[model samples]
Structure formats: structure tokens, C-alpha cells
Target chain A: MKLIENWFSERYSDNLQLSFRVSDQLLSVKTDFQRIDVFETYDFGKLLSIDGTVQLTEKDEFVYHDMITRMPFYYADKIPEKALIIGGGDGGAAGELLKLGLKSIINVEIDGQVVEVCRKHFPKLTASFNDPKVKLIVDDGIKYARNTKEKFDIIIVDSTDPVGPAEDLFNEEFYSNVSRILNDGGVVVTQSGSPFYQPRGIELANKGMRKSFPHVASYVAFIPTYPSGFWSFTMAKKSQIKLRTENVEKGEYFNLEIAKSSFALPEFAKKLTL
Target chain B: MKLIENWFSERYSDNLQLSFRVSDQLLSVKTDFQRIDVFETYDFGKLLSIDGTVQLTEKDEFVYHDMITRMPFYYADKIPEKALIIGGGDGGAAGELLKLGLKSIINVEIDGQVVEVCRKHFPKLTASFNDPKVKLIVDDGIKYARNTKEKFDIIIVDSTDPVGPAEDLFNEEFYSNVSRILNDGGVVVTQSGSPFYQPRGIELANKGMRKSFPHVASYVAFIPTYPSGFWSFTMAKKSQIKLRTENVEKGEYFNLEIAKSSFALPEFAKKLTL
Candidate 1:
């Protein structure tokens, strides 16, 4: 007797890959921008992939969303009232931002299909789309960042890796445009890729953000579903970026100590920012 | 066209696995203790596997070795003179300890074949084995810890996962014996498995060590090749554990900030200690 096996793998490089045994492919769609796929896995729960890369898993999405959103929110000088989330079509970032009592959140995603698909399959992440404060816009984030007339207290570039549609988001011009649309003392944070597997992600984001903002810092979080299980995020602010309070509420992966310690990068990763 | 591909994968669970494409299988041996295999990989350099789990990879071994050895050494009240390493057959732990100007290091490994194989495939890690201050003891580490009269300034439990040959190492009896064989103000550090994948590793170590030591704390480091790319370590000391200095010479993954921040556990991981 022969047994049939099904697996979904994301190849980090020619030599390294991570595989998850899947029970079924829940959804596969070819959007105008990229292909989005979701799978039902035995261990990681629901798995989401974009362009053959692991974006988030049901079991570990809290780590990514919590770090990406809460780190900058708490570090900002003031409680941000208005937030602009670029490329967060899945609504996870917007959901996290909403908890902070923001007056408004504008999530500009390039692909409408991603938002539609996520709304169908990822109810928890996409639930924020229906919130009165969250305004979902299916448009190019780069264009929106460049042309927006409104000012924001916080801008989160929750984009994919600096490739394909999100390539422009990591350049100096995009950050300069983003800086122009920010209120005084505003903070902007971008999701840099894994420093271990893709050092250029942080390097490019850091180099670009440094050109636009007075102070920029890079921090990391452990997202087991992502490449190498280590992921990076870069924050740029008009003022200093420091811990605002020790009483910040803790999430699954976020706490007062982690907020401070996440910036303590390994030597190899620290060198990438320089 | 016909294409051939070779890959070595370690299944962490029925649903999850990590695979590395190998250029060649350098060696495969079965000793009295376990099966040892070595492979030359494309990205990770040489890979070493014992009992089908990644023990070390040339690319990321520094993260594991540095955290396991240096954190406790730096946190110790005084400079550690004598070090006892249990089950670190790869010699990486001893190599790091030697850098701290230790008086002597006794490495008790159950399987001598792991040492012999590593010496041939990974000369850099095993180079410290021949150092005058280092003694190679081919014996059961648990037995040695239970019966030995020697006391150490730092005892590092560098064993594999708490299973098979290392099962007894995580019990209260072993930690009690380890505490007895430590000099005043001595510290014992054990490599807890990934808290995300195996919470029991840290739980057991923390439970057992608390029985004997006045202070017990668990910390974590990012090891990409490990099961979840996140790993935990537990340290037990007779006195309070605090940062000793700020000028610890930086390793690839160890720095003064890391020395302090490694103790900041994620909320989920922190709950495991309770």
C-alpha cells in the first residue's frame, strides 16, 4: 500500500526550505498583483502565502501583527490618532491599530483580491475592515503615500518584501513622500524582511528611512512561520524613539521587556543596518 | 531534461519540517548512543544531525554556543574558573568557555563517536578539545554529575532534547547533583528546547533547578536552524542573577545588550515557567 502526502514549502534559497504538511488547499487565487494561497495545516492551523512565501500562520500571526503594530504605537511620543497602513490588505495590522483607540485608520492595499480573499477566509484579521474607524482603500500604496493630502500620526508600511509591487516602498523617495504626509512627531514603521536570510530588506529600509527621518531604528521579532523564524521591523520618527511606559498591556509576544529588548540585535544583524 | 536534487529534512512534528539541500553526505555513523550524520550543504555550510535533529550548523552554531556558554559566564558573580560541560560532544560550548580564561573545562559526553566525527568534519568547533585546560571525558554525563566529587564554577547542561540518553538530565535528581557539585556562588545553565515547539523543555528544567537553587531564570535566543528558530535556556544560581558588566566582548550573537535582554521572555514563554 502507498500513502499519499501533501506539503507546501517556501524555498528561502536554493539550499534552505521550510515545509508544512497540509490537509488541503483551502484557496488559491491569482490576483492581478500576485498569487495568494491559503492552506489548512495540521500544526500551524490556517497558513497564508503570497507569491510562494509564508505571510502568516494562524498559530503565529499574533507575533507578527503584535510586533509590527504595537512596537511603534507605544514608542511614539503621543498616542497616535490617525494611522496609515500601507499594504495591510489582510487587516491584521489595522486590527491591532484599532485597539490603540486611533481616530481613523486608512489601509491602502494595491490588490483588492487580497482583501476580498482574506475577508472570506481570515475573519479574525479582516474583521477590522467593517469597523467605522478603519477605511479600506483598494489602491496602490505607493501612489497613495505620494498623493495623500491628509496627515497621519503614524504610518505603517506593512508590505511584502522589497520586491514586485512593494519594491518602491523601501526607497528614499517613498519614505520622503511618507514623511511629508506625517503630522509633527509622527512615527513611520515598515516591515523589513528577515535579517538572516534577507539582510538587504533591513539595510534598504534603514538606508531609505534614514534619508527621510531624523531618527530611525530597527527591531526584530520571532515569527516562526516566516523565513528563518526571525523577522525585522524598522521605525523612523521625527523625534526620539524610546519606551514611553512600562505599563503597556502585554500581548501574546509583546511585553514591556520585549519592547526594550527587541532592539538588541545580534552582531550579524546589527551590522546589516549599518 | 532530467534533474536530480538531494535534500535532508528534519521533521519536527508530523506537520512541520525543515529541509536543507545538501551537496554531499560527508559521513553517517551509528554509535552505542545514537545515530550521527554530517552533510555539506549549500547555504549552511556543514550540517550535523544526531538522532535526526539538528545539533549544529556551521552557519548558525555561534548563536547556540555563545548563548549557552557566555550568558551564564558573564552573569556569574565572579569570573568562572572551572567549567563542566555535559553532552556537548561538538565541543562548541567548551570553545566559548575557553575564551573567558577559564582554569579548566571537563566535557562529559556519552558518545565518543560524536566528538570523533565532529573533529574530522568541524575542526573549528572541536579545536578546543586538544587545549591543555580541556579534559575530554567519554562517559555518561548524568552518572558523572551524580557521582563526581569535583566542583565547578559553572556547569552547562548542553545535552540534546530531554529524551533518550538525556532524559534523566532534566529531572530534579540531576539538577540537585549539579547544584551539590558547584562551588559557592556557582551557576548552572541548561539549554531548554524551543519554548514555541517544546514548552516542556524549559518547564522541566525550571521546575527541577528551582528545587535546588535560590535563583532560577529562563532566557531565550534566536537559533534559525532549531525547530522553531527560537530556543530557551534556563540558569540557576546560588545568588541573584544579574548583568555583571557592560564590556563583554561581542560574539557573533552575544553582546552586552543581548546579555541583558536575553532574559526578557515572551508572554507565552513566560507563562511556561509558571
Candidate 2:
């Protein structure tokens, strides 16, 4: 491991910054899209950042990956066979989809550098990228979702924050395209930021989701690496979503009970949905 | 506001630190028991730290207070009248207890400095301390619980982490004393640490609670100022605990739905309790 003495800090907001004592800088690359940096930290194991924002940490990536991939599957009436992942360059979401035994997954990632670097540094996150079921595609997710003739049983917009390249993906038009490309009874799940720190972000995602689907709701999963740790995911379905699948898999964070319970929001979170 | 260029950072672990930009240092007191420092933060409003650990921030204090006081009330067969609060020197728990319209509340705090400082700095948290229902007692919480002659309908252990003066509160002996002084169908709720970063802390709390009461379980509430933002509370009772009281109070984080759902832990959290 390459060693360094300087600490790596991510400014979560104008007032809050989270600092990690780094043991080594594993890789740094500046692509046309965004800057990617991977570091080996003393306590959190590995860290990934894009444009100075923490994308995932090895210690807590499983919590995000498990919730994003497994929560929607539990609500589906039929077993999911095909999934389309948008902007999950880290491959964490793709790896989780592979666990569902899906026949195929079209992972559209805009930043190839993110995937290439994470593949080298975070093997655990990219473990299933080499699986035959996952088809990695380097393209703009909104464009692909709009133009693709193929319909997906499940569509996961595992994009970054609503800024830069991922900004378009958080709009009504993108959600409308997502609705068009989804099979009957298909569900779309997108990571909405923390309600505590970014309540407006969740409100925007909820408004966009409601515009495209009859049934829309936000679910919460606590991720320590993310801002506020109280992260949310907005789910939109053609029909009202309910738990239909039983224990298809046992995970460290997601289970049948959690799938149903995660949707129950605290009063402040409920206000954001309103 | 007394502006400072320097940041106030709390070291979460050997390698992790959370820093906040401060507008002013409102109070800094080295009490005989613990060091209490209150600051006006740029984003989180007011922040309170004890022994160099963040106890609460104005932006998220309601989430912690609402969950701690309201969760156990749902498990009680009757409206909690005589409630006991230990180590909630900040007065956040006492404020919440007053909302229940309790007949009497005995708040035993070891550190008077924490209470006096917070009362002056954080009026929102300490608003109800002067209410006729609350009785503030300055003493050791463990000794107070063990030696009190009066029985309580609810006993809330809102102590600090399992260290220094608060270490004895995490043991089975303290929980046994809590059981002895509780009315029938009473509940003992203690602030278990975050399940993400401090799983062992929660496990130990659960073990101790189980040793004293037949029905013991842990619930979760996301408090952004805490270590992982994902915090847990361990509850023990003489018998099975379920939804008995309804609509006692509405809060920013606590509700009937949240009370029922918070008990449904993520798979990893469930493993911690196991």
C-alpha cells in the first residue's frame, strides 16, 4: 500500500466535513466526466470518491448496495429476470442484481474511469461485473433509457447526486422515459439523498416519480458513509407496490421484514414526502 | 455569534473524525463529572458535546429525544405517570417526558453543569425542565436507580456512552435495579449506541437488558449528530412488549407507525441483537 500522512476530508456541506486518516493513496484519475480517487484508510478499509464527494466506503457499501437492489425485488409480483442499472459505475448495484439470478443486466455507466478504478481497488464491489449475466455499457443513462427499445422488469437508477451528469436523471422527463421502457408491473428505484440534509432532493425525486407513475413512495436505509446517514430511495411502480416475494435471499441489511418496514417514515421524513 | 476560523472536530475512531464549522463557542465548563462544551454550529444550529463526544445538535436533537421518550410509552399498558430519567442532563429527555402529560418525572443527572449549560444554550431541548411535572435531581444515575424508594412507570436511561461515569449503567446490575423499581408492565429504555460503528455496544446493552427482564429487544432511530447517525435503543420489560398506548404525542421522528416499524431492524442489526 502506498503511504501518505495527509488526511482526506470530504466536505459534506458548507458547515460539515468528514475526515479520514489515510494510510495510502491507491489511485487518482481525472476523466472528462469527473475526478475519481481511491484511498486506503486506516479504519474504513477502502474509500472511493468522485469530484471530491464520497461515493462509497468499503465499510458501508454493502448497506447501500443491499438496499438499492433488494428492496424493489421484494415488492415485485413476479421474479425479476432482466434489470437495467443506470450510472452504477462502482458495480456495487450490479453485483447485488446478480444475486437475484437475473438473466441479464444492462449497466449503463457514464464514467468509465470510475468503473475501471473501482474494479482495481474495490474488488468486493465489482465482484459480479465479470459475471456473464451483467452487460456493462458506457453511455449516458438518460439517453439510453429514452432510446432503448428493450423493456426491463426492473430499472434501477443508481446515479450520483442531482448534479452534473446525474442531474438530468432526476427529472420528470427521465422518469417518463423510465416508465416507457418498463414492463408491465415493473418498478423503478432511485437513490434520493438524505432527508435530514437534502429534504428538497427527496421532494424533487418524489414529485418526479409521482408525475410518471400512479404509485410512488420513498424508502429509507441508514448508510453511515452518506451525508446524515439517513439515506432514502424513491420507488415508482405502475401499481401500488406491496411485498410479494418471500425470503429469496438473506442479506446483512435487507430482509423480508425490513423490506416492508423500511417504507415507514418518521414524521419529518413524512413531511418531505408531502 | 463569536466567530472562529478553527473547526471543532470529534474523533469518532482512531481514523475517523467529524468536523463542524462553528459560529460561536457558547459555553465550556469542566464539571466535576464531565467536560461540557456547547457551540453554535453553522449548519446544525446548536451543538452539545460531553467528554469530547457529540451528545446532540439542534437540527437532529428532536429525533433522539422523540424516539427515546415516545418509544417506551407505546409499550406501556397505561399512560406513563411517574417517569424517571437518568443521565439526561441536557434536558432533552425531560422535555419529551413532559409532552406525555406525565403526573410526575424525576430527572436524576450526575452532572449539573451539563444541565445548567444546556438550559442556557439550548432552550429548545430544555424547554420543559421547569414544568411542574419534572423534578430535577443532581446525583449519580446508577446509585439513584438502585436506591430510590419510589417505583416508576417508566425508567429512561439516557446516559452517555459506556465509559467513565456512565460505564456502570451498561451493566446487568444496573438493569436489575431498574427492574426492581419498575411498576408492572413498565419498560426500561436505554440509549444503545449505533449498530453500524458500535455493534458490540448494542449487543452488550441487549445482553444486560435480557439478563434482568424476560422480554428485551432493541429498536433503531436515525440521529444524524450521533456516531453513525443510525442509533439504537434497548428496551426491557417484565412481559412481552407491544403497541398498548396510542397517539400519546406526535413528534418530528416518533409516531405510532415508527414505533412499530423501528423494532423491525435491518438484518445486520438483528444479528447484533442475536
Candidate 3:
């Protein structure tokens, strides 16, 4: 086979590549922090790529946003009022929090270019930035966590894979700072890579989270554009978390049944971290 | 991007393609029914393609085979003595059933080349075909269901996407024949395509199954090699199917927790076929 077209391919792993038919490459920029590229695809609609990796697609951003934010929210005993998001430059995690009527959400993102690109191209995610409660700050999340005296009821780390610019977010020192910055009974959730393809990432994150919190659990969700379509999240809190049984406003993906089911790991996944 | 090597690409949809880095093309045969191609890949091990679509891979076949066979078996009231598999020429579903102490199993495959190919290239999936209780029959599943007077306690329709050679298996008449050949309290499960990508297929299969059985439900499983990471299955039973809570022998991908969790559909999936 010969290549006659410009295809946007994300090399998910050494052997796997997920490619979308590109109608146009909307923007390409090499920021001081990382490379950012945005494209208009035929099926996935608009796509935002950071450092040759898919950040989020217009079609299925809800799956990632809903699972990462709402799962922690569902486990928390009380509805969160003040929250903090780390490295979600695409604004997905913050956007989900804004919908839940959080009083204040401080999104500390290191890459201003990612936020700028998403604001210009992806409205569904960046629209929350205009809300009064969401404060977008361009700073290192680890530095912010270490320096700030402010406390939060919920802390969400939406960083990229545990490599390059986002690598520090997965270490024990950062998690200890995150623990310091949270109020009593506060909860924290971080994106753990796919348990199937990236077991080492999940294990490292789980090991780091277990250092600071008494209770820690991991969950899985399906995001098609992601590698292996199986994504995991590691969460830690002071108290035991129960499934949210109440009926709330639902999105394209999340619900109470899925909330509980997301934590049910397969035997293969359960053995990954151990 | 430029392609410098031989890449085995499966066009999942009109606008998306899943490609694997191909190290070698082991076999390529144009059988009487469909094209069968096998390749050795970098990460996914050996790959099997039928009619240009992925049939199974050495790494993740357990996820698909275990969910399809185990779920129905879990719901059946009694221990299944006899079982029948339709269109699973790779011997995956039969392989799972053979693990149980079932009395007998008959696998009806439309194409013999798939069995021959899988038996040679993918031993993990085809090893159960040699079991004394397992019988392989080369014939159309619909014709076999219509002609055979023998009834089964469990019937598994492990066909491909409801197109081309497997098109007839999705119709109402075929489901009616399946209901006829099942014993009282018998359970049936079929692969409905990804609810996100192929809603029409899920809807049609759900509609057909609703015609024959009193209880019908759809569940999801994640298989990265599929078009979408999320895949759906439609199951119908004579009585209310309760979640299996008892401890049972577990597989790498299937356990009581995953068996119950698989039925919890996301909101988008809930609306896909409804």
C-alpha cells in the first residue's frame, strides 16, 4: 500500500497507530513547553493534539471528561464546592466541574499554548473558561501545589502521560503536596494510563497515590481515540467511597451504573499493578 | 506522514483506520467464502484478518471469547450440558466452553479456511478444537439452526459484523430459528457491533431478539483491536436474568465483577438502541 494523503496518525505504542482521515490541518505550533497541533478530521470532527499525541477529540471528549471528574465527585460524601485541576489545558476536567455548579475551580496548567489553541478551536471544552468560577492559571501544578496555602475539597490531575513535562505530577513528592493542599475529607483523582498497554504507568501512579492517602482505588473507561480504548484513573481519599446512587444530570457517557461498573477491573487489570 | 514499512491497516470506518506494524505476512489466502490474511506484528503478536477486517489477535482474544460465552452461561439456570457456537471459526468461543465440564459442543462455521488458518497460526484459541467433546461443522449457521433437531442449553452467535457473509444471521427469521432450537430456559448471546459506531446494528439485533425472548439486554466490553474500543453484545433469555453473584472459576479477562459490570451501559450506550 502507498500513502497518497496526509493522515493524522498518533503512534499509541511501539506496534499500534490510530489514524484519522484529515480534512485539514488547522494549526501547528511548537511552544516553549511542548508541540501543539489541531486538525479537522472527517469523522472525529475537530481534534487537538499535543506533542504528537491526541489530547481530545470533539466527538468523544465527554467520555474522558465525565469519567475523570464525575467518578471522584460521585465518591465524595458531599458535593464539592472548591476544586483544583492540574494540567487540563484542554479544559475538559474543569468544564465538567463547572457543570456541577462548583463554587470555584482553579485550573493550573503549565502549557498556555494548549489553552490558547483550545480556546480558539474547541469551544465545547474552553467555554467553561469564561465562567466566573473557573480561574485558568499558567503555572507548574507541582510548584503551585507546593507554594499555595489554599485548600480544596477536590483535586483533579488531568496531566498527560507520565513523561516529559507532566512527569513530575506522578511522583510521591507532588502527591504529598497535593495531600497538604486538600481540606479534611478531600478527594483527589489522577489520570493513570491504560492498564492493558501501559501497566507500568498505572503501577507507578498507584504506588505514588498509596503513599499519601489511606484509601486508593483505580477505575477503567473506554475512550476510542486513546490507545487500547481502555483508560484508567487512580484516586485517593481519606474515607471509604461508595457508589453514587442518586440520579443526576447525565452526559453522553456517565451515569450511576457506569460509575460503579468503572471500578470493576478485569482479572488481567487487577493483576497489572500488583 | 510517510510510510516506510509494510503496515497492516484495517479501515475501521470510512474515516478511521487501525494500523499495526507488520513484521511479516505469514499467510494470505482467498478462500471460497472470504479472504484470510495472517500477519506477525510487533506488539499484538499474530493477527488474523477475514475479509479485510480483524478477526482475532493472539493477545486480546480472551476478552472477546470469555465475555461472549461466560455471560450467557452465568445467566443460565442450570449447568449447561450441551452448547452450540455459530460462526466462531477461530475456535475461541468453543475453546472457552471446552474449559467447562460441558457434555458436548457443536461449532458451525461457514468457512473452513478460518479454522485451518487459526489452528495453524493461533494455537491458544484453536487448542480446544481438539477436545473430545467439541465437534467442528462446516456449514452456514442459519441453515444448521433450521435443519438440526438437536437442542442446546446455550447458543452463542459469535459472528462478525452483520455484513457480507454474516448478514443473514442478524435477521428476525434467524433469531426465530435460534429460539426454536433452544431448550426451555436456554440462553443466547450474539455480537452486536460497537454501540457508538454501529448503533443501527445494535438496534436491529435488539429488535430481532426482543421478538423471540421475553428478556433482552445489551452489554459492553472493551476490545482495542475492534473498530471502536467499545463492543456490544445482545442477549436474550426466557426468564429474568439476574446478575451472577456466586464465585466461579475465573479467566484472565472474565470474573464475577466484570461479568456484572459489563451490563452497566453508559448513558450514550443506553440511548443507542432505545
Runs in model 3 with CA error above 4 Å? A1-4, B1-4
Model 1 alpha-carbon drift over 4 Å, by segment: A1-3, B1-3
The DockQ score of candidate 1 comes to 0.89
Sorted by TM-score (best first), the order is 1, 2, 3
Q: Candidate 2 chain A: worst 10 consecutive residues by lDDT?
A: A242-251
Ranking by DockQ: 1, 2, 3
Deviation of model 1 at A60, angstroms: 0.8
lDDT of 3 by residue, B226-271 (tens): 8778899988888787755565778888888888888889898888
Tens digits of per-residue lDDT, candidate 2, B208-233, equal 88888899989999988888789999
Compute DockQ for each candidate against the true complex: 0.89, 0.85, 0.80
Model 1: per-residue lDDT, tens digit, A203-266?
A: 9999999998989999998888898888999999988887779569899999998998999999
Per-residue accuracy of model 2 over A11-33 as CA lDDT, tens digit each: 98888988899988888888999
Listed for every candidate in order, the interface RMSD values in angstroms are: 0.7, 1.0, 1.1
Mind giving the per-residue lDDT tens digits that candidate 1 earns over B174-221?
988998998877789999999999989999999989999989999998
Residue B103 of candidate 2: its Cα lDDT?
85
Docking class of 3: high
Q: Indicate the residue-level lDDT of B116 in model 3.
A: 91
- Candidate structures ordered by lDDT, highest first: 1, 3, 2
List of chain A TM-scores, every candidate: 0.97, 0.96, 0.96
